[model samples]
Target: MSDKVFNKKIFAYIVAVVLSVFCFLPCLCLVEAEEQPSEAPTVYAADVSVTQGSGTYIYVYAKNFADVSGLDLFVRYDTSAFTLGRATKGSFISSALCDVNAETAGEIRLSYVSVDGVSGDGLILTVLLYSESEAEIKDYKVDIIVGDCYDSGLNSVAVSASGCKITVKEKQQITETVTFYSRYEDVTKRKGDEVALSFYTYNSHGFASADFEINFDDEMLALKSVSLGESLKNTDSATFSVNDKTDGYVKISYAALSAAPSYVTVLEISFTVIGDKDGQTQIEFISSALYNSDLTAYNGSKSIVTVNTEEIPSVIVYPKISLKAHSVTYSEVELDIFAEKDTLLAAGDFFVEFNAEEYECVDIVKIFDGSMIVGNTAFKAGMARLSFIYEDGISGDTAIARLRFKVLAPCETKSEFSISGSKITDKDFNEQIVEYVGTTIVVPHDFSNEFTTDEQPTCDTSGSKSHHCSRCAAVKDVTEIDALGHEYIHHEAKAPTCVEIGWKAYDTCSRCNYTTYEEIKAKGHTKAVAVEENRIEATCLEKGQYDSVVYCSVCNEELSREKKIIEALGHDYIHHKAKAPTCVEIGWEAYDTCSRCDYTTYKEISEKGHTKAAAVEENKIEATCLEDGHYDSVIYCSVCNEELSREEKTIEALGHEYGEWIVDLEPTVSAEGREYRKCLRCEHREERSVEKLKNDDEELSGCFGTLDLTSIVMIVAIMLICGVFVKVKSRKSNR
Candidate 1:
């Protein structure tokens, strides 16, 4: 028991067993920890490879999510081998609410949603795969099916699908094979012929290069040169190019450092046939290129060639004219002669020329269907000589003669039905092929009576004359002229003043300057005689105006009169009655003095004294307990300063006024004589009584005093041993 108190009581029982197992093992591991259930949203997909006709992109993903707010998959694919272009919407649903449906071409029904809730793990849809140019290259799986999955607290989101593998590749096969031909399919040139046209090709795969573009019919052939054909002329390493041969296209190019002949003959072209009415020249192969010696791209076939051209036997005769209006300006024109014969005319002779300053060959008939017969008929200057004889052998169409012309002015001519010395005697009389379709008879220049002198017959008004018909604008000679009388002049006569009215001789019309207004009769105001006088003086209150300056008894002129104010003798006012000013006053004014003319009016006299001021408080002094009182400050004349008005009088003060001493009650010890004192300026009170504080434990402070219980049990066992020695020194410094 004495080995230092047995090791301080065995270290206080090992410091209370290590503070009671450190507060009970963290409350028993938080009551057996447990909480880990979440990790449920899956949705994957991703696979694609595409090539047959290429295009690919496949995503889906959405891994361990949380607030995913909706997604409904169902993919499938292989719709005969993929082809579903466009689904897109990934970034984890930034505003989703999608819904795609490939309409059953192998199933593709997707649905997505996110009305604000899409937590974690990205990408939810991308799709778009294509591969089907005839598809069938391989692999192709793509199968993902979920149905409905959600989160944002609407729970139920536990889906896990995955499938994708497109693959499909095989797409690239051109194999080359071009062809375009024309070795004369149907050509037949004649009109100044020159034709050549070759253009042939057939390449299965041997082409190093080839490019051509040919098009014809530039107005029936013209492009005359473009060689290089003997299968590219021995292939001298074959390199040819030609571009500038344009009338309607021709561009060729050939390149072959080696292989180039699967049957070739590129181009020969060479055209001429310069059109003359017989047409046909189509040869087209506009743009063709076959290159495949490693420069891949060969697929062709184009050939169209046509050439024709041969007619030329002329026998045209024309002049079957008709004209109602060709911008009319003609005086006369008539022509008729028709004979476009391919053969069958027995006899003929022709002559027609015109424009002798615009025509003059009048009449030359012979057309009764009587089979032509109008012999010698000659004219000189404007030329016209006809001698026809058809002796009844005229086949088909006929109307062989009729000519009449006569227009000599307002001319705009073009008459030259020319046919000089022509002869046609077919029917085996041999000498036909007569071509003469000549005719130029334009007669337009008649302007019907173009007289124009619009209006010029002026002497007193009435003129109009016109004529306009440049070509049917028809309007001829509109005339009207009559009125030329009145040229009398005389002006100057004005005499009548007194109140005016006079004019008896005035006439002026030097050709419509028209003037005449005669009247003479007002002379009745002639009794004025006050040469100059303006007296406007009537005083005291206005009523004056007399201005006069008369002098026109018979026109002596000088008038300005304003009389009739004579009754204004009304201001004889001599008023003088007014005097009102009181209250300590000084007033007087009310005047009017214009007995006849001095004119005077006045009013202004006011000064009625004494206004405001009545304050008279005499000296008053009454506040005593210690001085502070005053009154006296006089001011008189509210109208006269009534009675008491002192300026000095209050002076009194004599009573208690003391301060400093503020403790009212503070005294104790057995209350022998409670003290009191007061008077800090009239709050005076005083009561005195002291002496009674001496208790020497009077009988041990009696009150039936008795028990000491062993000194209160020694101060309650010394405060319970000092609170157990300060909680055992705070658990030995917390162990």
Candidate 2:
């Protein structure tokens, strides 16, 4: 072909392509520019009422949510009337990457992002608040402020935010009886011994103001000093005045900025024994006035303290039972019991009590190796008993036994062990004075609520995660995740032809290197259509011989060769003109042939097979969750440039692996619950209904007294908030 003609054809092709593109692009643009009808997302909170001294959860919901991928939301509420508790991610954002901050007073900030945007309506956040008992009965607002939100394209999404009102109702008042009393029993002290007595006040309603006047026998007991106790821990203003001029009275005026403890030590008074002879005197609270935060007077009692003066004993020896920690761990604890006596030679019996709910008794080994020896060691429920006798005597601090206990509640907890029903006898079998002291063991923090992934699993390597205590941040549980084996992709092999070398089929890892193969073998030449090479015709005049070669059609390689003889004949020559070569076929110069004889050779015209081919995709199908799909890579033929499709491949489907159930709606006394469990692989949800609420009056155990249906339901709602949702890392795949 002429260069000019080729240039013209190429120019025409360019113009056609440009025109086609111009014609089609505008229609696509028009379709893309057409907007879909949708409303802006609305974020709102729910109106709720809570009883005083109780807690309730506030939910932030989203409506008309469309194509929303991420949000940075803020909520504000009054902190004066309520204290914040746990702030958690709701079901709508359960699988989304989220961060929650409730550390700031009166404000909560939540940030969430999803790879595939969420739509429709659901809960986004849940916050807990405890209403102060002393807070005024009024309404409060929880507001959703303006925040940043975005769509899957990272374009800003306009969000309409609204807030809700919370009403705090007055709790039903239970009459609380407050008593001011001296808890001291009648005490005997030697002359000149200082008499110190403590007075406590018990007010279930919790007082903020109090005034007390105490009168002692001033003639026999001289007033020394007065000190405030734990009840005044919150006292913003307090005035204590001694009325020595009035002979026997002391005035204590107390006021607190906050409600004081319900049960606490109020005051301690010390007096000097001034009576010349042996006698008894009374230190009594003559009058008292106490008011709660509401200024309601607390019922009071006038209790007296009696001090008896007695001569010191000639031989004062006090038998003592003491406790010392022997060993302590996260799972077990041991305490050593000891006996101390000033006078030697004695037999004794001891009883110990512990909180059964916090610990379990494992073993008690007697440590006292003495004459006669110990007897009757027994334990039950919350108590342990041990008795021992002496043939001669044992005294002066001797270890009695080692008490071993298994920790039941391992989280940071306190267990108290008390000694009771203990008695010691002298060698003569005479009862002796004794004092028993109890001890408390506080366990270190252990695993409870939250878990963190320490290492992520790979295709070949395992991972580890640990559960930590919610309160103390101590690791209590450690777990290992199994390794995921290699995901393999099957690679089809290219078969060898008569002349071409071929590759052997092998599998390769999509995740990790599990198996490998690179071996290839040569095929024993399978014959294709054979082509004759270097052939000559027989002539008439002379005997003609030619070498005949057979070439492989598949790879154009010489396969076989043979020499053949032909009969010669006289030449009858004919002349042919030469032809020029063109792109479509080959041409040769002029040649001659004989008429009626095979004498002259004639030039032949030939065409060649195609040398290059570009691969094209055909019959493509995308893989789905339930079925496998495949596509083919079709390459062109060398000779005709027609498609010779090869290398068909398949994509495996992903099966569903579901996670734990997520509670969307909690069961109530009046309504059934709805929940859904999602597949971990694809985020597909399977929803189901839960059983209706049962009579759970027993579960309603708390400090809150008799409550109405609304308050009761609020309590139940908080209790039913289970920790079943597994917090996962950010997912990158789109659904």
Candidate 3:
């Protein structure tokens, strides 16, 4: 072969070897030119969620050839009903677009010049990408229900890049439905117990509500709760409660499972109750569907129910002891009984009997059993197992049940009075007493034939003028004029003719006049009515004996000051009813009454001060002032700049002299207690400006300015590692 032919053949072989090496390099793999794209960029906002007062930024990134420049940002958010804006840089400037929920809507855009060194973006050709979707909702805490008509998979979000995340930024709230919880109180309740039941019908928008009757059957035996929720999302729960008066069943039927406000979708929820004797004493829950379209509800939409109950029993009592009163009429006896369960219950009755161990006498007396409401009967006298029976309102089924109570003897009280007599000459006493003015005599007994005595009597016997001091000093036989013509003294008063000078017949008295109790007894008068100590001559004539009025010297009218009695005058007793109201009444039939007391009342002396005592003479009051200031606090009489003088002087006023001001007392403590009147005195204390205190504020304990060089270096290191990892992952994914 010739030299030229050999050279051409070798070159062709070399070309083939070079192509094989290039293919093995991996970085120079050939790609189709048709796949290279170049068009004006766009930013598509998938969707988003943000709360008012919160801030977050979204990025729309695009890659281009080395000569290509930046792509600006813009947005349209009025559900596409918004206008677009010219390009601007991709950056935040305040709580603006970055704060997705910044209260400004329509569209959001990130724009910039092809900003290589802030200059290249002027070229204007663009490239674009998209951010997640946008949702601007107020109150961040709103319970939300988002119905997506465009797409379906929010239940589990997927991002374009790893580590990029999406969250339910704001909660959706249901305005149409108001939910609540229910609970059972009985220990017999179990985890799946249908302890109560009721029914409710809801409207299409979840508003109008009406409770109906519960219809029970065999299938839904353990009905936890009737609820509504989304099909895929595992949302929170709704609650329910029971007051026990529930029927054996319930029915829940609504126009639809969920309501419509912005969009319509099905709502779902599950109910869970853990009891089996484990439960909550009270319930806390969100409200359920109640009001109708106009926010109105049915009559019984909200109601309370109560359960009927049975009671336990009382078996036996001990302390086998007895007590005979000092008078055998009253005393106390104690007895014991056994019971189970720490329960509180209603009022009840017991029947008990007592017969003396040896002397079984049937005398009426009261019996007590430590129960204040428990009544005691009157006991004549006796012993022998003061047996009584009682019932308890709290019973048990799975346990042995018993309760305890005690019995006690009771007593009745009676007030006693002793009769007595008094003596003095009414006219004679008046004549002999100037110091005795305004004072009168009081005794415990009454005397008759008091006006018959013409002479003073002694304790011993005297003639008709001289006397046997018993009923009267002396008495006349007015019976001589009677049809029987017998000599017996008559009970009559003497009428004075012309009111001639003093006749010496004076009888009933303890301190002012004289009277024998025997004579008072004969006239059939009680001691209380006849004798009172302070006799006011004015009103005494009306009451006969003065107990309440004071002697009035001017008008001669009775000066009636209030009288002291156990109860108020005209209001010492009251009457009342005994039975409690039942379901038959509209809530309350037993209001407060005092008919049995037989009177209305006034505040007792203890309750109202100054009820009787008169005011004393007033004194002239004075004052002194002093300064009270602290080291740290600043104070000023903002109105009057006048410096106050601090001194203390005792001024007598309102009938009394208040004490002086003591400087030694702690001013801080004193200032807290006394409300100082800002008068001509305290005007000094100056106040400092708040602006001056601002300088004392603390500075943030952090490094400011761009991140430290060290941090930047670390970030760069992390980015490098992540980029390598991503590249490897990409290769694997492609493979």
lDDT for each candidate structure: 0.65, 0.72, 0.29
The superposed Cα distance between candidate 2 and the true structure at residue 712, in angstroms, equals: 50
Model 2 lDDT per residue over 1-735, tens place: 654675566556556655655566666556646754457679998799997766677888989998899999999888889898557677787778989898889999999999999899988887778788787898998888858899999999999999999999987664555777676646677657788888876654677776666666555777788866754754565444444433456667777756777678888878887765577777767433567778876545567777888654467546667788988877888888776745353677777788888887777786767644343334677777766676566656777678788888756687788886545777888776776788989986655566688898888799988987654657746989777667788888877766456777888888766555665555555445544445666556567676777665565577787777778666677898887654357887788877866656667677554554788778999876677889998798665676656889888986777899999999887689999998876678899998877656745553355554445444543343221111111111221
Kindly provide the TM-score of model 3 when superposed on the true structure, using C-alpha atoms: 0.15
**Residue-level lDDT tens digits of model 1 in 1-735:** 454684587567556544555556465445534443566667776566765755666777778776778877887777776666556456567577776777777777778777777777877666666677789888877778898787767777677887878788886665555766778746567767787768666644676677677666565677878876776667657778788433456677778766666787777777777786666667676434566667776665567787878766686564221211112236656666666444466676777766677667677778646565564434677677776666655666665677767776453445555755556676456666555555665666444454675676666677666666665555655766665567778877887666778896798877677788787876766656775367776544556666667776787676566564643455566787778776666567877776676767766677666655767666566665657677887766676554434565555655665454444454445556456656556675656666556565755665334534344444554565566566767766776
For candidate 1, what is the lDDT? 0.65
TM-score per candidate, chains pooled:
0.21, 0.22, 0.15
RMSD of 2: 45.2
Model 1 per-residue lDDT at 473: 54
* Candidate whose TM-score is highest: 2
- Residue 555 in candidate 3, Cα distance off native in Å: 99
Q: Candidate 1 — which pairs collide?
A: 329-444, 329-445, 329-446, 330-445, 330-446
Location of the lowest summed lDDT over 10 successive residues in candidate 1:
319-328
| Candidate 2: C-alpha lDDT | 0.72
